[model samples]
Target chain A: MANLTTKLGRLQMKNPVMTASGTFGYGTEYSDFMDLSRIGGIIVKGTTLRERQGNQYPRMAETASGMLNAVGLQNKGVNYFIEHIYPTIKDLDTNVIVNVSGSEIDDYVKTAEIINELDKIPGIELNISCPNVKEGGMAFGVSCAAAAKVVSAVRKVYDKELIVKLSPNVTDIAEIAKAVEDAGADSISLINTLLGMAINSKTRKPMLSTITGGLSGPAVKPIALRMVWQVTHAVKVPVVGLGGIMNATDAIEFMLAGATAIQVGTANFIDPAISEKIVEGINDYLDTNNFSSVTEIIGALEI
Target chain B: MKKFILDLQITHKVQLNKQNVLLKLTSKDLLPEILPGQFAEIRVDKSPTTFLRRPISINFVDIAQNELWLLVQIVGEGTKRMAEMNPGDLLNAIIPLGNTFTIPTDKNAKVVLIGGGVGVAPLYMFGEKLNRMGYKCVFLLGARSQSDLLLLNEFEKIGEVYTTTEDGSHGEKGYVTQHSLLYNPDFNYIYTCGPTPMMKAVASYAAKNEIFCEVSLENMMGCGIGACLCCVTDTTEGNLCVCTEGPVFNINKLKWQI
Candidate 1:
């Protein structure tokens, strides 16, 4: 078998198939469908300093080959995660990463500090790109200055690998990636979700309660690949790519586009056992192409 | 209950009406134990416009035939594609999802199952289970017209069926709540599933009469599991996922205005 080990700064993955945040719950949710250890990493739901009730009833809308969600980081705060959720996931064999979000800088720093104490968690993916929340989600991510400020504040208290997740809603994602890297981000993961909306012609109303939400699925693949390529060339830090990664081919496309690692998002909703299949698919591709290691394809784009 | 993602081959397809189709599916292995109010997320393949799996309620399970039935309504692209499937087509589905309805302990307790449109699907399975358990079942089904009413013969085999159609072509000339049988509903328990407004009216009537009631909610969902917190209902406890916490919930737990 071809070697599938992947490295992003201090964080090492057995393979490059990580589940995007908000899609995969705590690793326990999918324990019945597939082996959780088969995944490279599991980024738990976005946790905040305070509990959030999230948006109203209709928070989801299905579009052509994609879906929109305005589930504004509905979580029970980080403390509940440490007390209730941590113990269950701490013993999982794969890398367990927490995706942290906040309304203010202090909230991000405090949540990161608390998670930093957890022995099992290898890193934190700072989510500055959640489009659903009203306060500091995509607000901080759209601006390079705000993105750097939040990353730098969390860097002071967080000692582990700090992976800043970049939002695609901005004009120049590469500039934001560079700013976060300069502010002490160990790695950068990109193309969180593109902001989009869906409308019902008959009802003459928006499909989602929030009118607009973050779009993820196969529809956003091309945009994610373009952003990953641009940011990888502009920044020095390793990049984790995602957005409509449904299979191993999609995962390899991200690698060829210069993403050091890749994540699978909306496809998880369609097929629960997708990540494991993707891991196998990647291995099959490596063996067929006679590549010795999975890392050989990173930034191997001919053009 | 344990959930399974199985490739079930369609054994039979019956077009109940222009808007509805009854698909009977079976696997090589014995079908898993499924409760009355639970649902299945069926994957719609080859449909370009459909992205997510469609969540359809379990209409019935014929144990002797080792089959599971799904009564689908052609409301959108996903379901329209489901209606077009042939007998030999393989449909992948995640089965036994969500919570089940409460089965009363007292066999003599007066129970009423109310449904409207394709909302009557799950209640058919529920009524059958209640009848097999030695409880007399009363079903109050509603539709836009006589033709829109589905599974009348099947429901009649298991319970005393009453219906209402807007066009006065069925039993009553008005909505299910307007049926004369509800004038003095001496029911001990009521279970309903239909349009939101219809279910709300049922909840209101049940609350006023101090009858224990439960209603099934059909909310837009992302993932049928607890992961995608998309299909949430405002309840007394907080925003709970309708997929995991319930497709069925007690009226008292709901935050309905009634």
Candidate 2:
């Protein structure tokens, strides 16, 4: 049987089916519809030091087959996550990965150190690709030097498996991916929301409070796939791909493009249970192909 | 997660005039407890232009038959496609979403119901529960024109019904507030769902009269529940999510746009 299990450094996943950060809010939100235990792991909502109120009205706008968001990490901070979100989710059957976002290097290190102290947290996903904020957002992930700096800084205190999420809004994503890889990142996730905009013709103003927002959903799948392929070849670290993946076919497409795992975003806005569907679809695809596990299919595509 | 295709069979489709379609649906299993002012995010797949799910207020819920009803208008591609659905076609729907109308109490009694446009549908469900419990009910309705009036007869069958239309084409010949304020009777608690303007008007009137009123807000939502934070209502308690904190809110608890 083709074994489906994969590892990010020391941690092992039953399957390579994971939920992306920002899109999957702490995993418990979707528990009402499906069992949380079935998913491989969940990279929960982004967190910071203080409570984040996020951007204003029209946080999301629809494009052809995709949507844009400027929800500037609106969440109760790390302390609140420890007290509120973690207690409930930590007991759940799945791996709980915290998606950490920050303005400074300490914010990143402190967040990672706090999660390391927690009992059930599996990993820390550093989000250096948020274009909506004014400072230290995607700037870190876009520049290889900054990416390596943040990666090394957080790596010093993280203690556990550290995944550096790469920003697609960059001149060369593969360079930053390699930088994080060299900085001791266990894995790399690609293509956070792309910077995009919308306009209200009558008012002649931008639709979102911020003139620009991050784009996600099915529209960016092709671009995200391209990045995943590029970064997968550039770095030895495992790659988790996301950006508008709505179904199992989309997930498979990423796997073919060199991503070892896949994350479901935007689709959560449309169908809350799509991840389960994607999981089922993957299992079905594996079973029918007579492949013993998902590992055989990971980067199985022939050039 | 049980990934069963929710075979949402359309039991009945009534085209209300030309603007709206009332789609009555039934499924295999019993639905969860759905309250007034709460909505269902329906996957509007009837046409290509309307692929995203349309968030429709829960107009009515028939618990006995495991069926639900939605009063949707042709505001966009979603509602327009929903209008064309027929019997036997399945429309994937997620129900009992968002916060529902806060019924008077843990122990119920006097309750007043209010409606405007398709918003009136949810009131019917609350009215049904109230009437069965023998709570004294008063209904205040608002509409653009007499013809635009929906479910008035159904509401009248449950309680005393009052109405107002902008063109003087119906009962009160004015806004619902005009009539509600004029005959401002003692309501132990009130429930309302309607256009934002109408609900705001009702909420303010209720606030001024010192009446305990719960108004359901309508916001453009991607998910009927609280993942997107798409549907939010600013309150005295900061930015409270309309999807969770309420699609329904107490008039006193709300911070109006004014």
Best by DockQ: 1
lDDT of 2 by residue, B1-258 (tens): 112335578999987778878888998786667776767788877343454567788778888778888888887667877787788888887776766666566345556787888888778887877777677788878889988888777788888888899998898888887884447456677788888888887787777777788887776666655776655666776666676777777777677862
> lDDT at B83 for candidate 1?
98
Error of 2 at B56 (Å): 1.3
Cα displacement (angstroms), candidate 1, residue A279, comes to 0.5
lDDT (C-alpha) at residue B21 in model 1: 99
lDDT of 1 by residue, B101-168 (tens): 99997999999999999999999999999999999999999999999999999999999999999999
Residue-level lDDT tens digits of model 1 in A182-220: 999999998898999999999999999999999999999
State each candidate's clash count: 0, 5
Q: What is the C-alpha lDDT of each candidate?
A: 0.94, 0.79
Residue-level error in angstroms, candidate 1, position B112: 0.1
Sorted into a CAPRI-style docking class, model 2 comes out as: acceptable
Best by lDDT: 1
Instruction: Determine which window of 10 residues in candidate 2 chain B has minimal summed lDDT.
Output: B1-10
